[model samples]
Target chain A: MSRIPEETLRVADRLAAAMAREMRDDRVAGAALPLALLAALLARALYAPDLVVLGSLGLPLAPSAWWPGSGFRLSLARAEALALRHADGRFALEDAFASVFRGRFAIWISPAQVDATGSANLSAIGDWRRPKVALVGSRGLPDDAGHIPMRYYLPRHEPRHLPAAVDFRSAPGRTPEDGRRGRRRGGPEVLVTPLGVFRFRPEGVVADSLFEGVTPEEVTRRTGFPVTGLPEAGRTPPPTAEETAWIRRLDPFGIRALELLPPREARLAAAAIAEAEGEGM
Target chain B: MLASLTDVAARVREASKAGRLVAFGGSGLHRKPLRAAEAIAEAAVPDLRLLAPLGGPEVDLLVLAGLVRRVVFSYVGFEFLGVAPAFRRAREEGAIEVEEWSEFAILAGLRAGVLGLPFHPLPGPATGDLARTAPLAEVRSPYAPHEPVAVVPALAPAVAIVHVPFAREDGTAFVPGDPYADRLVGLAADELFVTCDELVGPGEVPGPALFLAAEVTGVVPAPGGSCFTASPPFADLDVRGAIDYLESVEARLARPSARAAPGRAGGGRGR
Candidate 1:
């Protein structure tokens, strides 16, 4: 494993700890924290003086209304309320989607699986006639990836999740060559996984940065195919203290901490248990 | 006139008898017409084909009860809870057929239906192999013959069942959240049935009209009708209940003897 900077490790630890602390509560769902944190990050990255719609599964209310301690009202209704409050006028949902497709807005989606080429699968794991696993059908992903600029968030980054090729192409990624069928302006831009960050390139996906303590070898081992053009390994930029504080403010109940910690630690614990069993036996 | 939940189910049954396509609403538990769906499935209407953007417990229940013979949808699984088990079993058993569309295709198809067009042209990968088995046809662009375009045939549901936050006695309804494709489905369907948490007098309706009275065929007051799902201020999705239901269905499906249960045999209502 490549050595991770102490500071970078600390940042991942802190974020994981915060997520762990938030998970203690019974009400919060498993993906809620990471998703909310991702939402907050996206909101921060895209925030501007003018109104820009953040197209997600739903809308996000003001931090005060739906943040961690506020009972976390993360629903379509909450988003709708926020959209109504922020927009200058009313329009149909289709119009909003059309705007997103036209690249007038940005969207964040979580797919079941994504491949090196950026093709996503949310429909099935095997043949269409009878799938080994039937997932929620592809809603909007085809156009979302084909037209709108999208950022994908994968909570778990493993060979199965980030495969060499998705079993079924629910959404087609940008072609390797300039000549392709997708939108001229829109396609996948970035992928955020637990281990590292990647950006889509004409040739293929390239590793932009690794999280603290994650190695290029580790990433490649977990990935289905050999990842190309990994830059001289650098620490992923840690969340700024200000950004951390803003995240805390957005999730007053500390839900992010609780939601993130258990799984992170559980994996470590399992590894430790396996190591001990091997040594002792 | 205000209709009852049973009446709405009967209407759905009538549509089913006529071999009409039915479309429900929403992604998850939010804003779906669950009670009406359950009632329709319980009525044991056969040859029912469903056209929905997303599927939830109601769809699963109908599939398990053998009420739905075919489904044309984007996706069909319980969010977070995992894949809808009954749907998986039915698909595995080849008891039902599916015409899968990407979320974009389903929405675009509905738009085309509303426009009274034969098909809607779409760009990108959805036009590729995914369109092979689907009702999509490829056509050369008049301006650019070298560029191939995909055209998705319009999807017009015979009956659309939608659940909203508020509806007037006159049949116009209001949904406080993202209507998703509910409005388009309503507009594209031959008949629209709306179930609302609150029934209001005409002119007292709030927000924009999600479903116009002229377009809506029936207005039913069904408070908590979307129970175990969500209808906003009326109720939140009963997560515990949903998990319990999933477990129950899973357990029942696991039993060898239970495989021949009345629910799966097209006789009784699924618990």
Candidate 2:
């Protein structure tokens, strides 16, 4: 395995310790401190009753095992993605869209860029006609973002990703345009990043909770746009002992490492771990 | 009568020659008629306009082979595997014409075709960059002019190709799991061609028939047709095969001179 930077290791340890401390102290909500912020947020969301999550989260492990329900409704998933779902049933793309269109499911989207207004850009990085980097074209984001209750998860919290305005608004967010358009059913409820969890308000995006060891000043420095509600923001709650145990049990191989580690390292580490786990099985 | 993969390719080539729109069934990578797609690529059909609700390697294979003229799709990428490198490169280079839509709107278009309607009106918030790029028009309700609805025109493909997990000789086919727009595509197209992984006898199908015998124009019996893609109950996605294809595509992209015929290399492993 490639050696990780000493600084990165120290930072991870510090953050993990802080989260552990908060979990023991507050006991407000349960989150997994050791798991990536994205998984932790998902663990917290799993606590919600009868919730249906749509969209491929791109985690290394299957999320269905982690869900408290009998089955998590996974849709728009390819074979590779559905492979991760374990026992959960798959929904056809059309059926999945129908549910989202009807405002039945809370959709989770990961976008290349998310503006201050909460609009997501999954289409391209530069110009539409000839983009410098053409990402996946707006699949269902354009059709469903305004109508459905949406949550965003960004693995990295940076200025480039959290821009003042997205180059292309693939999905309309909390902007007045969405409200004026009609039937806006609470678009972009929250955005979870490694640094913190942010909620969209009528005013704009604000920090609801910062991750352990992540400060308001760090968030401000990282974000390109102005984000308020940090001064009063509290630490993101850590998962309960039971939740952590569930997470660890389900993901015995640290599959969350794929989301946590850098790209190259992630692939290598995940492969080695998966191989080891496979042999053990 | 059961057809062969060669016959299926010939039919698709004929459709291409007639300047007809061809729709491939499956979203992203699951249950895609990849073997048929590979056969089509081998046939070297030119200037084909392909429509998929959501595509992945099947669409990318054609694009890589330089057989595609235009693509009408909402999304086209291997979900976890990564982006559709060929499709992305083609669109970025303006080598292929693209009509992008939200999944809901495109499916609505397919529905319009299925229902024999000129257009289909979908509810709420379709207006965005995708709507602007797509061929959708806003129409106000005659009684309620205040409420404007975005209507997608009929998407009647000349031919629809699907990979059936389990099928019988008389054309009764069973889709083991999520029927990802396969039935809709079959109904919308003028000609429906099905390729199956397993050709069963009478009362031998593992599940209820999702594709009726009457609707099928041709049935091609090709076992493991959806390899590298998923056709649950029969096979899981061959992850290693998928990764190999992706890596090959990336390798080809790096060396422009090595634009060989994609054939099987660009598609799933022939299990």
State which candidate has the highest TM-score: 2
Q: For model 2, how does the per-residue alpha-carbon lDDT over A147-203 read when each residue is reduced to its tens digit?
A: 665566665789999999988878877655655777656476678777877888889
Per-model tally of clashing residue pairs: 18, 3
Q: What is candidate 1's lDDT per residue for A1-281, written digit by digit as tens? A: 01223433344444443222222211111121234433443343333222333322344333334233443322322323433343334445466566655565454456778887777887778786787777777666666665565566665678998888888877777655535453556666767777767777767888877777888888888988667756575667656665555554543332232223343343233233323422432
C-alpha DockQ for predicted model 2: 0.45
- Quickly count the clashes in candidate 1: 18
Docking class of 1: acceptable
lDDT of 2 by residue, B1-271 (tens): 6878788777777878888789998767677888888888888988889997878888988899888999988788876455788888888888888888887788889899999999999877465677668888889989989988878899999889898888888888887576767778899999888998888889685865778999888889877788677776665555556666776787887888766465463334455
Per-prediction fnat = 0.34, 0.53
The positional error of residue B132 in candidate 1, measured at the CA in angstroms, is 3.5
Q: Which candidate leads in DockQ?
A: 2
